[model samples]
Target: MTAAAACDTAALTAHLVARGLTASPAGVEIHPLAGGVSNDVVAVRAPGLDAVVKQALGRLRVAEEWLADPARLDTEGRALRLAGRIAPGSAPEVFDLSDGYLVIERAPDSWVPWKQQLLEGTADPAVAGRLGSVLGAYQRATADRDDVLREFGDVTAFGQLRVDPFHRTIAARHPDLAEAIGHTVDVMAASRVCLVHGDYTPKNVLVDPDGERLWVIDWEVAHVGDPTFDPAWTIGHLLLKTVHRPAAGAGFAAAGRAFLTAFTESIAGALPIDPAQLVRQTGCLLLARVDGKSPADYLTADERPRVRDLARRLLIDPPETITDAWELLA
Candidate 1:
């Protein structure tokens, strides 16, 4: 079915019923969920199901005409199932996957997106640590697995959702940085070490109010690629938060540090993380958020230039370590 046609609530409800996922179409309630630009996400409440359904969009819901394969929904469902097996509770259970829709366990109402919590000036170091550990475990468990590499070899979704929108967009905007950005892109494309959560940002992580449970969601871009990509994507967001909320910079910086420490510690001896790649990727991400197709809404017009300048510095004179990069911001 066409992406536009699949977005129709009545059509979606019919599809669910046809797939036998819903017992009745009359009582099923599907409401759109906020904060997704690449897909139609809905909270589904029915007689026997409380789940979230995501339908991948061929063209993203952004000002730019960003396009991607709707088949990436298949990748996300597979990744969630694998993650559940590798690290139980880290990712939601996939209840169903058909057509371009993925139905998975819904997070409790008590759980809020980590991005919301971070934006509210609440930087919990423990949350960062937990994210780091869970991600590390995922990478470690899936690393060097030939079966996994075969299953997730396609980088089409990652390219469309991330590399094109962020790295390539930034490169085009800043001609001088194109060479460095191109090199980073080359390295990431060539590397096939482990499974990478291509969008490992705070927005994708859901946390309980009491900080007891953390669930990583949205694995549509998951692929077997560079290990640094996940950590870099994550730390880059924390840095952006620091810039957006300067008053809470110290707290954000601490969270970044804690995240890196826990991440490195968790993967120690299991997989080696390249400091240079991490630094370069982080720099690319920093620039991307400012100049990419989907710029961070929180960054002011004036703050964008500062971010661009810092990103350029990091790209040209790459940091020796993640801590050094954080220090530059500090």
Candidate 2:
């Protein structure tokens, strides 16, 4: 069945029952969840089941006509399973993966998305520190695993969802920087360092209200590629937030520094991270969000050019350290 047709709540309920994930469809509360731009997400609550079910959309919900393989769902499931094994509680428990649908444990109500908190101007350094530490551990644990390399070697989804939309799209728009952007693409394509969560923005990170636990969600674009992509993606979002809410820029910058320090310290001895590569990727991502298929909605019209100029400057004169990139906003 087509992805659009399969998004029906009734159809999804039936699929869950057939897959033995739910005992019955009766009294099951299936409500749609927001914050997703490429897939259908529903919160399923039944007599004894409380989970989030996701079905990948062949055509993403973007103004641009973007298409991706539904098989990315399988990759997400596999990534979640691996993350659970590598760092238990860092990712939701996958209850079932059938066809193109995935049902995973739904986080508690108190666990809010870090993006929401950031938008509300509550910049918590602890959130960044936790994410850095967890992601670093995952990458270190899964590093050099040939089996994982083979399983996630296909960068089709990552290319379609990330590289094509963000890096390539921006490169086409800014022809002068095409060489630099293309170079990063080629380097990322050739590198097989560790598991890269292609989309590691704040929106995908969930933090408990009490500030004790955290979970990283949305691994649809996960792959085995450049280790810097995840951290770069994350810091890029924080930079955008800094531009969007300048009043909270100082706090956001601090969070970025904390996250970078924690991440670098966590993987200090296990793997070597190139500071220049991280800043280069960060520059590419900063430009992508401002002038790519999916632009950041939070930035104002006047604010976009500021980001554009900063991105270009960074690309031309890349920083030697991640902290130096943060200092650009200062």
Q: Against the true structure, what is each candidate's TM-score?
A: 0.96, 0.96
Q: Give one digit per residue, the lDDT tens place, for model 1 in 1-330.
A: 356545688877888888888787879887878858988888889888899999888999889899999999999999999999988999899999987779899999999999999998989999999999998899889888899999999999999999999999999999999999999999998889899989999999999998878999999999999999999988999888877887888888889889988888888768778889898999999999988999888889887887877788889997788667656766
- Misplaced by over 4 Å in model 2 are 1-7
Best-fitting candidate, scored by lDDT: 1
Error of 2 at 131 (Å): 0.4
Clashes of each: 0, 0
RMSD in angstroms, all models? Answer: 2.2, 2.1
Candidate 2: tens digits of C-alpha lDDT, residues 1-330? 356544588788888888887788887888888858889888999877899999898999989899999999999999999999988999999999987789999999889999999988888998899899988988898788899989888889999999999999999999999998988888888789899989998999998987779999999988888999999988888888888888998898899988988988887668767777888899999898889999888889999998898799778888777667657766
**For residue 89, what is the lDDT in candidate 2?**
91
Model 1: colliding residue pairs: none
lDDT of candidate 1 vs native? 0.89
